[model samples]
Target: MNRPQYILLPVSPIFIAISLIAAFLLNLMPWGQFIAAPDFVALVLVFWGVHQPRRVGIGTAFCLGLLMDVHDATLLGENALAYTLLSYCAIMMHRRVLWFRISTQAMHVLPLLLLAQAVQLLVRFIVSGKFPGWFYFVESFVSALLWPLITVLLLAPQRRAVDKDHTRPI
Candidate 1:
């Protein structure tokens, strides 16, 4: 059996920072009242948490969550709590998640996404004493739906090209 091998590409810290920043910007975009924009920053955080736990972990998630909290004008630390838990879950499951195909990985991610939303909802309820209704949970499904796409786009830069010609001194 012939197996294809891939070169290991070097990951730069700057690239990860830029991706997080972009995600934050995306989350900040105005989408009107009708459409509840998905939490792009949280999604990106999970992606990096699973792929590069060492580079992006609990601290990073907490910081991003705080920024998101400020961006959305929500109760402070609400997103931080959710994001911290989400990142911890992702880090713990990173090894297992990497074994599955991107499509299959969504199944693993669905619960986590839901958990993050649930935490956020719980926090909101505690602070405001009101629920945002069923529609508020819609973004969790939307985030899960985009998981495969996120995996593909984020991993694109990290995929090392397989060299066909082997020219090495033996």
Candidate 2:
């Protein structure tokens, strides 16, 4: 039996902004301890960087990082540095990563997330002169674990409704 294919609707820039804003607010919410609280902003930034590289690139990542830095009241460039690197990785692997299913994509995403966290940890260590401990790495793994969910949620608005009449082969 032939299956119907659903086309993607055009994603509006406004939707992207709303998602990033929502992610920022989610990141701001206290999740008991820092280790358990996944960095929603970073995840969303990576998602956009991968899916919409042309629209959301290093500059956007840097600006969002600055905003996050302001929100968290940390060293101004801490997140900017990490996010810039994350965006670079996402953009670099976008085509290759997009070819995989979301579950498989997590394997590809692991290093990028870990690197972003490492940059943040390094920045904190340099300025504060203290190691945050192994628990600090938990958030990166958690962020990777949440990648499939994040991909689904963020892509929901862009999923087009199935049109039966349009099932004819092009």
lDDT, each prediction: 0.86, 0.87
For residues 11-111, write the lDDT of model 2, one tens digit per residue.
Answer: 78999999989998898888736348888888998999889998888998899899989988999999999999999999999999987888889888889
For residue 98, give model 2's deviation from the true position in Å: 0.6
Our model 1 lands, by Cα RMSD against the true structure, at 3.2
- Model 2, residue pairs in steric clash: none
Candidate that would win on lDDT: 2
Model 1: per-residue lDDT, tens digit, 30-149? 882658668888899889988899999999999999998998799999999999999999999999998777777888887888899999999888888998789887887888889999
- Where does the lowest 10-residue lDDT sum fall in candidate 2? 1-10
> Each candidate's TM vs. the true structure?
0.89, 0.89
- List ranges where model 1 is wrong by over 4 Å: 1-8, 162-170
